[model samples]
Target: MKIVKVEEFDLRREVEYGSAEQNEAVRTIVSDVKKEGDAALLRYTEKFDGVCLEPAGLRVTQEELQAAYSQVEPSFVEAISAAAANIRAFHLRQKRNSWMDLQPDGSLLGQIIRPLKRVGVYVPGGKAAYPSSVLMNVIPAQVAGVPEIVMVTPPATGGKAGIDPYILVAAAEAGVHEIYRVGGAQAVAALAYGTDTIEPVDKICGPGNIYVALAKREVYGVVDIDSIAGPSEIAVLADDSADPAYVAADLLSQAEHDEMASAILVTPSEAFAKACQAEVERQLAELPRRDIARASIRDYGAVILVDSVEAGIGVINKLAPEHFELIVEEPMAYLGLIENAGAIFLGPYSSEPVGDYFAGPNHIIPTNGTARFSSPVDVDDFIKKSSLIYYSKEALLQNGATIVELARREGLEGHARAIEIRLLKEGKAGTNNDNQ
Candidate 1:
């Protein structure tokens, strides 16, 4: 990792989501799925995942879900269950109900909150199992009362013929019954456009590689997506009093995610920065994913020397990291100063992994610089809101003139006349334009 003074260091680090060729590849996959449906879905699944299946074999069967229990150990089951419980409990608080407000004029105005009828959650598989993602994506939608939840994953996980047993168990634990063995841009396309085998979903949620991200971007309007997530990143804001070991270890946690992942450290004290940099070197040597972490730390990691922790906060806001760890004294005092970041971790004890797994908050967060505008996945992602307005005869008669005048001013004759007819019938058409 390169160490530089914050004042002199360039803040610009380009986030590589994918190249144009990658986006075009994803677009073509999406287009094929849209046009060919199940036939195209099967071809792409076989082409990319090396697994060929019939239409009927696309969906995971009840027998497979049952068999998954026998394959995994009891301890693994216990741990996944505990994690699922925490996730479910947290999202249940975000549940919303349809509400209305009554007025004196016998008019009812309110917002109706409705859970999306069907939702699709994409879990990354095929040599990588993300039971955590399965829990994070499905629990919120379930809390929102979504009737049906469809899950799609790569055809083969760890080069096996079937899905990972742990992933299946996790999805089953989260109350997601419909699991499909398909992945990549084609699965996203299928979820958006629908096929005879897989029905279209109202929204798609979860993280994947650049292909998955670009696929979600391609089918965004056809189906809503959580966000076009970039690679994982973490920024540590520390002071002289912070522990160098803890800060360095946390930075390495994110750095090991991928070669594109970023792990940055910003501190006021030059000595502390040097100490943490050394600790990172020591820890990185032992990490099993050292090559990946080394590349990430080498290419993207940095130690920035800021004048003060407050000044460091300014740089953090500009970066808008997926995870921000404040390892200084009185961390909460500076919480309000942080304007961007998907999730904020205060104090040395509150590690980033805590929130990623056991914590109730969803781990699916905004990535790259998107934390400035986007938010973590939550119950709101699985529901829709419609404004309700009930106009009684008296209310319409009382407000008709004002409505007609505004409509006429906008040159919408049809709208003005619609209000005009009501006012004339109510014998209130003669009222003054502004006051009415």
Candidate 2:
């Protein structure tokens, strides 16, 4: 990690929008899936995942779900159940009911909040298992009252010919019964355009590789997506009072995610900055994913020297990081000062993983400065709100003239005439109608 002045440090890292070839490949895959349906889906599965399956084998059976429990340990099930409860409880708080308002003019106006009919959660597999992601993605949609929640993961797990047992267990624990043995851009395509095996989903949510990201972009209008997420990031805003060892560990937690992942530290104390930098170096040497973390730290990690904690907040606001940690003496005192960040961890005890795994907050967050305008995945992402407007006869008569005037000002005579026709039929228009 390099140490530099806050002015010299730049946090506007470029997002990977995928290569032209990757985009063209995703387009071809999406088009094939849309045209050939299950045939193309199975072909892509075998091509990319090195697994062959018939249309009947695409959907994971209940026997597999039950067998998955036997593969995982009792402790693992207990832990996942506990985490699911926390995730479910947290998202349930975000649930909203449909509501309406009655006005004095006898008009009914409000919003009709309803869950999406179905949602698809794409969990990345092959060589690694993200059971946490399964819980994080599925639990929110369940809390939103989505009738059907489906999951898609690569057919191969750890380069084997089956899905990861831990992932299957997580899905079952999260209340998702429909699981598919498919993944990547093809899976996204299948979810957008229904096949004989998989039904179309109203929305898709989860994190994936560049191909997955591009696939989500391709099917955005056909089916809504959570976001075009970028590489993971973590920015620590700490002062001299914070511990360097704890800070270094927290930074590496995100840095280990991938080479593109960023881990930054902003501090007012030069001594503390140097200490954290050395601690990060010491810890990086021992990390299991040291190669990935080292590359991430070398390319994207930095220790910025700000004039004060107040100055650090300004830099953080500009970065709009996906994950933020405040380790100063009084973390809450500066909480309101933070203007951007997808998830915030305050104090030493509130590590980034707490929110990532067990702290009842969704780990799927906006990345690559998107926290400036976007948010982490929540119940709202799984639901849609339709505006309700029941205009009474008297209400329309009272506002019809104003509506006509506004419409005519825009040179939309058709709109003006529509309102005029209603007003004239109600006996409210007198001598003002060009229709006469």
Candidate 3:
């Protein structure tokens, strides 16, 4: 690892940026699915997932789920159950209540909160089985009182038409209504534009490869989607007191995610920065995914030696990292100064994986500097709000002339006429100049 002084501007772009080829491929997949429906989905699944699945048999059945449960160890199932309980408990606090307010002039204003009719959660399957993602995605929708929560993942090889046992168990614990074995851009298309077997969803949420992100972008108008996620990233803000080993391990945790993932360290101590760098090299050599982590660190990772803690904080806010860990003397001291970040981990014990798996926070976070304007998935993602308004006759009479006058000024005669006709029918306004 190399340590460099912080600069005001770094012109080089990160390699993790999405490509035009991916966007075009996603567009093609979405179009094909829209035209051929289930047939297109089956064909793409075979091509990408290396599994042949008929549309009718795509959905996972209760019997299959039971078999999956039987395949997994009881201890792993217990852990999944525990994690689900914690995730559910945390998101339940985010639940919103509908409210109405009455005005003195016989007017009522309020907002009604309702869960979306249905939602689709995409979980990646294959070499990586994310049972934790299943919990994070489904638990929030369940907490928001969503009636139907459907999940989709790519089918495994050898005629396996369902998710791994851990994923299935987690989905069950999170109250998912349905699960399907479909993957990639085609899965996104199926969720966005319902096929014969898969029901259309009002919204889709999850993380996936570049194709998945692009597919979500193309289908955005047809169905609401979570953010277009990029590769995972983490930024550690530390001082002299921070432990180098802990810092290095935390950085590698995200770096190992992919060759494009970024791991940055912003520290005030030059000695600590060097120690972290050395420790990162030592630890990377021992990781099973060392090749991926080494490439990620060499390409996108950074260790900036800032002049002061304030400067470190400024750099963090500028980066708007997906996962931010504060390993300073007082991690909470600079909490108020952080204006942007998908999630913040305080103190040495709060590792990034804590929130990724067992912690209540949603791990489906915004990446690639999107945290400046976006937020992690939460209960609100599964719910919609409608503003309610009611005006009594007295209230209408009180404001009708002013409304008409405003409409007339805007040259919208129909708008003025609509109010004028109503007021005239009630005998409240005989002439526009009566009050004047």
lDDT, candidates in the order shown: 0.90, 0.92, 0.87
Cα lDDT of model 2 by residue, 173-273, tens digit: 88788899999999999999999889999999999999999999999999999999999999999998898999999999999999999999999999999
What are the runs in model 2 whose C-alpha is more than 4 Å off? 157-160, 430-436
Look at candidate 2 and tell me the lDDT of residue 354: 96
Which window of 10 residues has the lowest lDDT sum in candidate 2? 427-436
Compose the digit string of candidate 1's lDDT tens values, residues 251-289.
999998999899999999999989998999999989999
TM-score of each: 0.96, 0.97, 0.95
Query: Candidate 3 residues 1-436, lDDT tens each?
Result: 6788888436234544367777778889999998889999999888876778777788888887777778889999888888888888899999999999999988999999999989999998887889999888888888888898899988886555557777887777677748888989999999999998888999999988888888898899899998888888999999988889999999999999999888999998999999999999999999999999999999889899898989889998889999999988887888999988999999999999999989888999988788889999999999999999998888889899988888877877778889989999999872364233
TM-score winner, 2 or 3: 2
Give the range where candidate 3 is weakest over 10 consecutive residues by summed lDDT. 8-17
Question: Using lDDT as the measure, what is the rank order of every candidate, best first?
Answer: 2, 1, 3
Candidate 2 lDDT: 0.92
Ranking by TM-score: 2, 1, 3
- Residue 3's lDDT in candidate 1: 87
lDDT winner, 2 or 3: 2
Give the clash total for candidate 3: 0
Which candidate gets the maximum lDDT versus the true structure? Answer: 2
- Greater lDDT among 1 and 2 belongs to 2
Distance from true location, Cα of 176 in model 3, Å: 2.2
